[model samples]
Target: MKFDLDDQQRDFASSIDAALGAADLPAAVRAWADGDTGPGRKVWSTLADLGVTALNVAEEHDGIGASPVDLVVALERLGYWCVPGPVTESVAVSPILLSSDERSAALAAGELVATVSASAQPRAVNADFAGLILVSDGQEVREGSAGEAHDSVDPSRKLFDVTATGDGWAADVALASEFGALAVAAQLVGAGQALLDASVEYAKQRTQFGRVIGSYQAIKHKLADVHIALELARPLVYGAALSLADRTPDTARDVSAAKVAAADAGLLAARSALQTHGAIGFTQEHDLGLLLLRVQALRSAWGTPTAHRRRLLEAL
Candidate 1:
């Protein structure tokens, strides 16, 4: 399968990114971090109108029948914008759509928003906005705060301790969990690249010893290392997405590898970026900290490097 985006896809992604940048997420980020309903809700509506909401849905469900690559492109664009909402959860609804017609309707129509718990598969992965939820054991159909959730590391993104949505949706618990792991891993690949760029820029401008810090060997090596790590991890992420898209039998193993690699790269990239900026990167006033927070949260929520390794090794 083709790896790089075709011209059409590239243009589509660029359009989304440009539109999102114009809207600005600062106010929403602040509100969400404080545990309030964020401006992302409106952004989500806007995205829906732009066709992001239905890009991967089947035509019968009012979707565009886009490829998984298309979905990845969309998500990367979202990360670039730092846009937040239940969108990821909404996107994660793919496997469920394969299982239940009702769930498919909710996702495609955008009449519902959902989040999932990393804690369980077929469980409440959806953050309770799901008009219906699927746990491994069974399904529950309901609405609103099905469980407790706290403000996430990325204030704009919400997390939940969701227990049930109260639908009859059934998921292959193992498969669902594996898919979640991979999706988050792919997200980190995009995010880590952004963080690395942030650090490199900081290193060049911030001065030390009568020169730009980026000129120093220490900073240079670190940036180089991040670049290497991201390059290695990035293709693995694309491979996993491609494997999933291809409906390959090795999807789980490929996904696990991608997740572990990308998550580590992301954490290191964030830390290095912070260091390059010296003390200021640690402050909430700067943007690097936001990426750092996202790295920590996504790495743990889906599966740590250690956790993914264990799962992968067991397979071997």
Candidate 2:
């Protein structure tokens, strides 16, 4: 009934955290925001060296073979810096490795990047920086040049539009669809974690009326509410990941709930963070604004809170 990380899982997660913290997120995000090639291209090599790129891939396929808990931990670190890439695709594909006959082989290597199209949309977007694009309803799984990426709310991780060609054997359409949902849920949890951290830190540092703003009842209530949400959402997210990893039947409902809770938590935390910072948080110079933007974008992506809420209610 309890969910926790083992010593190995904690160490791996900590390693990724230390690496991300050392990577200098502010500078990287600033460069990325300025349209500097997705996540400051310079950090990729270092990230790869850190084994972050291989965290979720199968061990037999040359990956570190980290478990779902490990992957979740590493993803949290990635979100802490808002560093971008196909962590979603990578996580979703973890189980499909030996089950597929397509070019998915290169996908497991961690030498390449991959992302699924947001949905069954015909726009045919390739994952930016990803050598393999797992198009969900993609018309082209065939290999081709993944077109240049435009601005994304999370620009540190770029996005691409590519035609799905090649007559590759699509893996279990149903399972992959489910994984997509779970994968996005995982990503949102990371953002939610970051938002929680940002809000807590801001509440302590920002002062108003010659006193720490967090000391006031109103601010105390808001931050406390956010902390409550953090606790509520954390276990659900962990449960969703575990369910997906175990292929449990309740995964669909659990994943959807996790995704919705995470999206709401992230949005609430960001808003709370901005409010705690007051007007200064609105300024472009403050990192709080960036967090706001990320929360906004992430909430809408994968599936909106309303969409998942409806699904959850329907399940009940």
Candidate 3:
């Protein structure tokens, strides 16, 4: 069977790339880390204007009602730009978890931000910035509140202890978790690509022993491996998206497989990127640090690589 994004999906991806490309993403990310959300909110508003925030929400909720494939496409680009916040929570999981709520309209309009703690996960990311907080214990969902902030490897990803505050309702927590994993997998692919691209560019310019580093066989092989891993992970992500859209019986297994592949590939890219950039990559001033830190944090978010690998093993 043919597997590829259609023309409209490609165009939508391009528009998001262009819109985010014009934004001062580094500055926005920095401001977000310092507890200022203005710049980041503006970037999210831009995405909302492009209908990104509405992709998964149903039409009855004033959302675009796009497919899971479309959501993967949009989120991959968002990851490439390293847009900070509870991205998977707000854009992907919340729509399905709150499918019947009117607040989805506000989310579609970029008027509201949300964070979720599901499957007994104790902390919710970016809870302070979220107007809506959701907690699920695998069978039921309830509104929640942020209690205290916690430090993260990526400062831009603020974590909070959540406390349930209101009434509860039944929800498909398993499906919600799957969506979150799928979203994170897509973002991992995008972030890996970004890291690989930066490493490749850096390799072309930086020289050692009177030759450009790109000319070195070791550097070339390192980058080539990262490219191959990312390329392989992309299809699995898309495949998982398709499976979820079709509601296949294998959707959970596929999503876990995708998550494992993406986390491994993204971490490889991060390591290779830091190696390519040498010591400079570790410094706060370098932009590579941003992607590096993000990849680390995301590798464990929603689910850890080890956890997904175990899930895949269990499926087999």
Q: Pick the candidate with the highest TM-score.
A: 3
Output the number of the lDDT-best candidate. 3
Q: State residue 110's C-alpha deviation in candidate 3, in Å.
A: 1.0
**Which order, best to worst by lDDT?**
3, 1, 2
- lDDT scores in order: 0.68, 0.63, 0.91
- 1-316, model 3: which lDDT tens digit per residue? 8798889999999999999999989899999999899999999899899998988888988899998999999999999999988899999998888868888999888888889998624699999888999998868889998898899999999889988988888877888899999999999999999999999999989989999999999999999999999999999999999999999989989999999999999999999999999999988788889999999999998988888888899988
Root-mean-square deviation (CA) per prediction: 3.1, 3.2, 0.9
Q: For candidate 1, report its TM-score.
A: 0.86
* lDDT (10s digit) by residue, model 1, range 120-209: 332243253444443343333233245665565565555555454444444554555655666677678777888888888877788877
Q: Candidates' TM-scores?
A: 0.86, 0.85, 0.98
Model 3 lDDT, full chain set = 0.91
**Best first by TM-score, ranked:** 3, 1, 2
Q: Residue by residue across 98-133, what tens digits does model 2's lDDT show? A: 243333344444456556663522222225555556
Error of 1 at 173 (Å): 4.8
**What local lDDT score does residue 138 receive in model 2, on the 0 to 100 scale?**
38
